[model samples]
Target: MVNSSEQAHTEIGPLYPTYEALRTAAQPVHPSSSARRLLWMLNGPLHSAITVLSSEITTHGVNMPSEPLYDPATDIWHPIAQEPVSTPKVSSVTVGVCQLEEWGFTWCDMHEGHADPPELEDEE
Candidate 1:
């Protein structure tokens, strides 16, 4: 078996320092290729967005009526003054994409339990 030290790679310093000076913001220290920059920008933005969305969903779940609680139905925010639903089966149900429309609730109204014009019309 090869020792871990034998697999090490060497770090190479920039070969063309003089040419890199033209692009530096603070006196142009080094020039980076456009591809490297594009890669960084693309991956950085996507990673940041995913992180933010994840945080929002988690916070919303906790803020639900039941502390550390989440519900598959009535996506609206409510503060239930009783023991939150803790059954494993109920918690594990995967809600299909926005059944609010079928339930006569518009996307926005459904999540917030707001009645839309159509839903209101049906009630009359």
Candidate 2:
């Protein structure tokens, strides 16, 4: 005979596997061949500067500019403040629950209640 807890877990379905699949799908794509070729063609100084900029962007996410502003004095184009880049908040349990819901799994809080799954911890 299956225990109540076991039955409950079964009803919740396979959450971890679904969460893993979703997380894998969410990974960033590599730069295309054309973009790589263009990077290769860039001059040494320009290439170095671009490489540094790319590294910084990768390390600390950049805020997308809403508008471009050109200053005649400095002869530089600057980005106006807009929406900031959002940090990633990965919760496997939450994602799994959402995925289950997407697959037509109905949750009853009154019976099962809210309990944090083992994989509820946020991933870096």
Candidate 3:
């Protein structure tokens, strides 16, 4: 068995500096490489977008009544607070994706719902 003296000598020091160095070094120096740009886009913006979408969908049901909506059945669009449907289930990632797709919402790497156009300038 190891004694206290040996244990003290073997104890490792904090490695935060080393980790930071590695993280900084991993970034590509040149932005001209398409592959690198794609990877960067995926690792950065795409990841962030997915996280936000998952969080929003998990916290609030999809097709919120406060937001503008569309009904494929009638081929009509409803202004916000105009037509409200039952709250959609966004229990899991798959369910969220399905709900979004059903509502004609396309997942965007930069934004959550690409297909849903931004609100009119005056609405803001």
Candidate 4:
């Protein structure tokens, strides 16, 4: 008895949960942890600032960066560039998305164990 729109959303509901989860979770991890954990998992190296921040999160516990160096102009940290910066750890998922976007990475349902992001076929 579901409408087409409901059916469509239900069909797509399981995909792309990162944004939803991060958005709705009671306590989303700080951007520093999210960035460092993801980066370490992908590249095997922690952001220089995150090295200290991670230890503090492990020991003392914190949500914001221990030593933030953000730049209000760009709405991001200092040394803005394509590659992830070592200093000025990110503090929010929004900023983390910006960093990932810079690396050509986008939110994907596949990341949450669902199908990969859809790709369009080239017209022949």
Q: Return the top candidate by TM-score.
A: 4
Ranked candidates, highest TM-score first: 4, 2, 3, 1
Error of 2 at 123 (Å): 63
Higher-ranked by TM-score: 2 or 4:
4
RMSD of each: 25.6, 22.8, 24.1, 20.0
Clash number for candidate 1: 1
Per-residue alpha-carbon lDDT of model 1 for 39-97, expressed as tens digits? 11224343322111122132233223322122335553223313222221121223355
**Residue range 12-124, candidate 2, lDDT tens digits:** 75423333454578854333322222212135443222211222222222342222233455765433112122223222323245666655334555435555545667879
Candidate 1 vs candidate 4: which has greater TM-score? 4
Clash pairs, model 4 backbone:
none
Error of 4 at 108 (Å): 39
Clashing pairs in 2: none
Off by over 4 Å in 1: 1-10, 18-20, 23-44, 48-124
CA lDDT of each prediction against the hidden true structure: 0.29, 0.37, 0.34, 0.41
CA lDDT, candidate 4, residue 36: 43
Candidate 4 off by > 4 Å? 13-25, 29-124
**Candidate 3 lDDT by residue in tens digits, 1-124:** 9998777667843222232343466732222222111211134343222211111232344333232133455765434213211122111121245666656433345476565787777755
lDDT assessment of candidate 4: 0.41
Error of 1 at 9 (Å): 13
How close is every model to the real structure, measured as TM-score?
0.12, 0.17, 0.14, 0.18
- Candidate 3 wrong stretches, greater than 4 Å: 1-58, 61-68, 81-124
